[model samples]
Target chain A: MSTTAIPTNTKWWNGGRSPFNASYGKVMMWYFLMSDAFTFGAFLISYATLRFSLNDWVDANHVFNAFPFFGHQDLPLAFVSLMTFILIFSSVTMVLAVHEGHKMNRKGVENYMILTILGGIAFLSCQAWEWTHLLTGEHFALTKSGAIEMLNTTVSHNPWGHRISGEVLTNALRHTSPDVLRSMILEHNHSATLASLKDLNANELISKIDLNEVYVGRSGPAAFGSYFFGITGFHGFHVFSGVVINIVMLAKTRLGHFEQRGHYEMIEKAGLYWHFVDLVWVFVFLCFYLI
Target chain B: MSDNVMTAAELHMPHDTSAGTGRIWKIFRLLSVITIIELALGFGLARHWYGEPELHHTAILFVKGTMCILSLAKAFYIVSVFMHLGDEIRNLMMTIVVPLCLFIWFITAFLWDGNSWKNLKNTNAGSKPDQTEQVVPAVIEKGAKE
Candidate 1:
């Protein structure tokens, strides 16, 4: 217990500083990001397995065809491309903020932080639009009987690019009242007649329907809806938290908090988190939208 | 305590007058150009503009491979430059990077396992008849009028 009691010649442990030469907080943040990366990686791998498991899956090009105000155009990958640019641009601004922190320029830090915050908000809004478009829009499936089924997706069911079984339709039909069935068909623009309804013979009635023509409510796999919502929703939550972290950092900067600490390493740490969020988006873009 | 107090200027960090501003702008331009190139390739070749039909499977795979590589490149730039990971001490770099490499390995292993599961489900002899066939009826068997 005495200082220098044993004079060891080994120059092993350094004192009073981190061996990594980085702040403890920054290194911890990296560790957290790495673990978070694994979570995302697992989700994506699950998506791939299930997607490849199916004989046919919804193509990214078809699934994400909608754009803001354009209303279901074939502008494949356009909106996501813009979102990618915006996120990357925000990463640039974050780096600038960190650089300004290094220079002790409060104004530069504030300005770049503001830009980064705006970019984060814009990205979030775009994602909101994307989610709303996906969940609320019309989806179609080609039934096993060669009849098109007009479908709406819930978290539990997605009909896009998957075939609905005749049994599923027949079973659903058995439970549905005739009035409800007729109204559902008319609502979704399926040209079913009361004569077909009165027949009570689904196979005979479905035979009268045209091939390649759409009908209403035949269940398809829930995998697509589950994965899409699960993965993107997770990423969306990360973006939301990143924005919140940035806003807090911005408030502290405005309150002269970092100046009181004699360095802006706090800002640098926040910048690290922001950059990590943007980095995750790049992968999400590739997995969900592009590839 | 007074001797322990190090001034910001003494840290020798970049100042307002340094060439760091130019470096930041250069990185911004590089990122933008790479993104634009990725977008163009994705739009033109993958989507098949100019009267071309959809790409062949191999061609589509090639495009996807290119996009993945480009995305990794973008991630590298953002992490190294924006996060300043490249400028950090080697131990610090490894502290972040080595674990991430394991993360990638985890994904690859799971993806390969998942693919095997898919292949197993698809080809195994004892499996139930392929659902693809039963999913949609080829022809509706009309019953006698009841």
Candidate 2:
């Protein structure tokens, strides 16, 4: 019998270590991502369940219809599309960085990492703009008796619309001279006059205007603000953290740390985290914006 | 050779099997195309091109389904290609994927349960369910009576 005895002390035969044939660090990153995914999943599913049970939830289309600097042109889904593209492009840069890292191309890795970091910063800026616009914009709440009430919305109560009621116009008319008001309306080519703003009821006022030009308040399910802030804010926090990590990674890359290590596994690991962040955003986009 | 030699150029050369820059760019283009399509659908379906847009139950359900599918596809591409999960060993892929599937199932179950909670709260505030009528009998009828 020429059969050799099976080796008992070999590295591969060690109990329960690297059973998945991946590096320890890589497997650990996967585990962390899995847990983080659960946290996000719980938040989104709760949002959906609550939204479904509510009789009068705000339509996402109406709430997220604004674009940057376009000044309310009814440009629905445009800014978010741009935001989504930015994140996706950042993810591409991340993948390219990892690829360059695999080739042991130090300069390529550094360049791509820098691009990825810039993309992250851009996405964060866009998100900041969206949040600022949301918090500072005009809002209105529909009252029980069919009259629209202007609301200075805060974190607790955001009815998700811009309804400048007849009272507001009336107040504007009172504040400004007739010539100035006439010039303002003429400059904007608005059909409203100071006389018309004086005696109109809320319904009559709403009827006289084009709903697209004015912000029409949706029937908000009471928990809309809570869910919107909670889920999107949590996701935004992740994006911010991811950007910080990417900056750190970029610094390490430029310092020749990965090059000295003779492997770009660190870049690969960071790329995994970045891609996971993007993945979470996909779900968030669907839950908050699309569905 | 000095034992302090830890420089990258001194390290043993390993085989580099990563795809070329061109291939990476190609994948990027594909991802961009898919995302643009999703954006078109999102904008097109929501806008009132005609008159007042009605939110029919079936229409809402269809749009929701389409959005979910597209989002999942985007996630799949990013994970499998960009994260290189698909290129990993089968055991490794299973280690990540199986747990994720279970997590998704848990979310669905919990969400359904939450909807039930909302329904119960809305219909009968502070009223306890009749255990004999709604709970025990159901358990017994499901063949746990023995």
Task: Give Cα-based local distance difference scores for all models.
Answer: 0.68, 0.67
DockQ, per model, reads 0.29, 0.25
lDDT winner: 1
TM-scores for the candidates: 0.77, 0.76
Tell me the tens digit of each residue's lDDT in model 1 across A131-240.
88877776544444444444566687565542334565555445544444444454434565666567555454444433234344334457878888888888889889
> TM-score of model 1 relative to the true fold?
0.77
The local lDDT score (0 to 100) that residue A238 gets in candidate 2 is 86
lDDT of 1 by residue, B1-146 (tens): 56643443333233333545677777778878877777777676545631232325556667678888888898888888777777765666887777677756676776677666555654543266675354223212221000
Q: Cα RMSD to native, each candidate?
A: 8.3, 9.7
